[model samples]
Target: MSLSNIANDPNKRMILFGGKGGVGKTSISSATAIYLAEQGDKVLIISTDPAHSLSDAFSQDLSGGEVIQIEGVDGDLCGLEISPEKGTEEVKHMLEEEGVSDELNQSLSMLGLDDLTSDLHQNTPPGMDEAVALSQVMQIARQGDYDRIILDTAPTGHTIRLLSLPEFLDSFLGRLLKMRVKLSNTLAFFKSMVGMEAEKDRSVEIMEKLKENILQIREDLQNHTETEFVVVSIPTLMSVYESERLLVALTEQNILVRNVVINQIMPRNESCPFCSARYHSQQEVLEYARQVFSDYVQTELPYLAEEVKGVEKLRKLASMIFSDA
Candidate 1:
């Protein structure tokens, strides 16, 4: 589908841009947010990467829970860099406030298989960051105030987890919740025989909230036709391979991928060895993308003089992306 087809309508809340690391997913996602905001929509640009670059893209310090508005954009352009560390902390705080002590909470969090899961995540693996970051996005969506929500996701592995979340957690949570209820009832019966009341099931409350969030997202994704998935990749072997895998995964989940953005294609100007080699490599990858993905592919951003970080540079980058050349 065309940009006009997607952007003209404001109801499309979840616009996702994802692909390999350093493939310009953030830049394109930021540009799309800026472009949409310029069109008079209230746009919230969110970075679902632990190592966020949205602040760098906007040339502003956008930390904390506040939404910093972009100056020049006609409509609302709020930028957020989600902190998953904050998310985990929030969950911990909620548990604590509900009378779960620091000691008990720590032991509870540490005693389960979740402790091993914590170790795996603490290693700073690629996809774990994305999974945690996706929760941050869901939190923003839950607020339900924005005209559009643009998700600038982490690399492919993380993004794969984020997209698969609906299917991945749905059945998993269902079975776990059932088992928890059964076990809780069994424990309650034992406690009654001993003349003691059973412990309240706060676990059920938490699961219900989580399930609510997941189901709401699933519904938003299913019905929100304006929600589009844009993939960004450079014309290189590794990026091509990663993008293809992501596409296949999204297809399997029945997610609609609207565009494949090829970032940093080598320009045909210079005859330098590096540029020439990159040009040839990009040409091969572009051919592969067209054959495999066809019309879903849209826009090729050329290599720039320096990495795009500041707002001025990002504006130039945006110009090129939205340009007809």
Candidate 2:
């Protein structure tokens, strides 16, 4: 099974593991990152889910802003959990620079806007996490520090917002930036008349950088060779249907999704009626997935006897998924 073309395609720089919540995407993404790192590729795994689980999957505290090197992995693997709250703080700090914070604050204070823009992240619209996560991807990709980037994305609905955000955010931000530039010009003119120097247009700088990142993100994500998405799901009616919706949505966005992971496939216990019935129900969904999702490569991950945590378990999981090559 071509589970994200990791072993097969050397050109794919970004791979995203996403699906319904609690579908083992974190485990899969961490395993894949381990696999690539062991293969001598510098790999970084990032968790975009606000409910970060990379720490639990690897038994480490990855909730911090800095990238943490994963212990006990076979190769060069580092992990980061990017939080929207953290991104917002970074923006606030940029706006309030060293030695400039006091003056900038006083200026805005006189303008009677300091209180409103003080905690900027609070006023950000809904789904800012998705936008922030995508921005992180663009930032990382631009840096060229890692050979491969493995993303453990949010659940289905939020992930859709992330994948489709490039174009929508690009256009929306474009218009917004235009209006802001006009306002900045007006402010600059007024400042000149008052015999005062105009404060630097920091928002324009940040927004322009964001616009550039969004455009690059869109181009890279749409290119099949540069990016791939693996949908992780379980053999159940609800999860399977949602996986189908995720697949269709990806196709519509022109993002590449060449692999489907059907996690937690259970075995039948002949003596227990409940086990047998559950297996039957799961089998039906498996077969349905085989037909509807036939266009992409499909792989089955059996239900683990224990939680797949720490390095040993993750390495084992990686063997099962990527050992096909």
Candidate 3:
């Protein structure tokens, strides 16, 4: 359904923002987080973009590795910026500490190659940062402390790949881990007969742990009540088209998609012919988006005079979202 309808749904616990780059998804997500916090909910906002600007949005430095609180909200309003490189390193550290050799352990570096993992990670495709983001989201959900979780996701194409990762990884890793375990056992038996000990494969063990994490995220997505995907787009032909395809992809995955947020609409400026013409052009694209998406559409946010940054500005945006003014 439309963003307005979904936001009105009290049972929805997670709100995700995704769209083409520079469509104001981050601003909308920040506003939503602030609004939820004002409504007496503990809200945790996360950014999956490598070039994260949540700290800029909040006017505070929030690059700490964990969830950090935003000072002004009435309820819990924490922010996290996930670095896939960092997450990959974290996994590698675990593997090495567990005693895998440098030669064999280098495979752990695979996790750092997001571009290489794009095809596999498309449905939760492997090695991409989106997987790290999803896992982080799952961790927050499992903790069960926050009333709401808002994610300022990457562009639509990337976000879709991330969302699909859980299922794809679940099946892929499950079967692979089983095979690895069997192979390891067989190799150990052969080494015993030769009077030599077989060393453990730390890479395999790391994969197994990642497999478990994927399974849990898959479970969380399936539950539906706790997670929802929101697609944000600008009032432009290209953005709308991308979002249309993204929606179809999500439906195929059986993922529960809640709303289509149309952001950064040109405000009516009667005196400026350029502004008026652009507004009319946006209106046409907006109309097309509504017709194509039907009930799933919501109006875009008007361009503001000043950049939306800091808790005070975000609160104003939250006000605008809920109010006519």
Each model's C-alpha lDDT?
0.69, 0.79, 0.73
Candidate 3 residue 289 Cα shift, in angstroms, is 0.9
lDDT of 3 at 133: 67
Candidate 1 — which residues are off by over 4 angstroms? Answer: 1-4, 72-75, 95-139, 142-144, 166-175
Candidate 3 lDDT tens digits, 73-119: 87778998877667756555565576434433233233342332232
- TM-score of each prediction: 0.83, 0.82, 0.83
- What lDDT score goes with residue 61 in model 3? 78
Please provide, for model 2 over 78-127, each residue's C-alpha lDDT reduced to its tens digit, 9 standing for 90 to 100.
99998876775665566455322454445556666565344343455445
Between the candidate structures 2 and 3, which one is better when assessed by lDDT?
2
- Cα-lDDT of candidate 3: 0.73
TM-score of model number 1: 0.83
Give the lowest summed-lDDT range of ten residues in model 3.
115-124
Pairs with backbone N, CA or C atoms under 3 Å apart (clashes), candidate 3 = 120-125, 121-125, 121-126, 122-125, 123-164, 123-165, 124-164, 124-165, 262-300
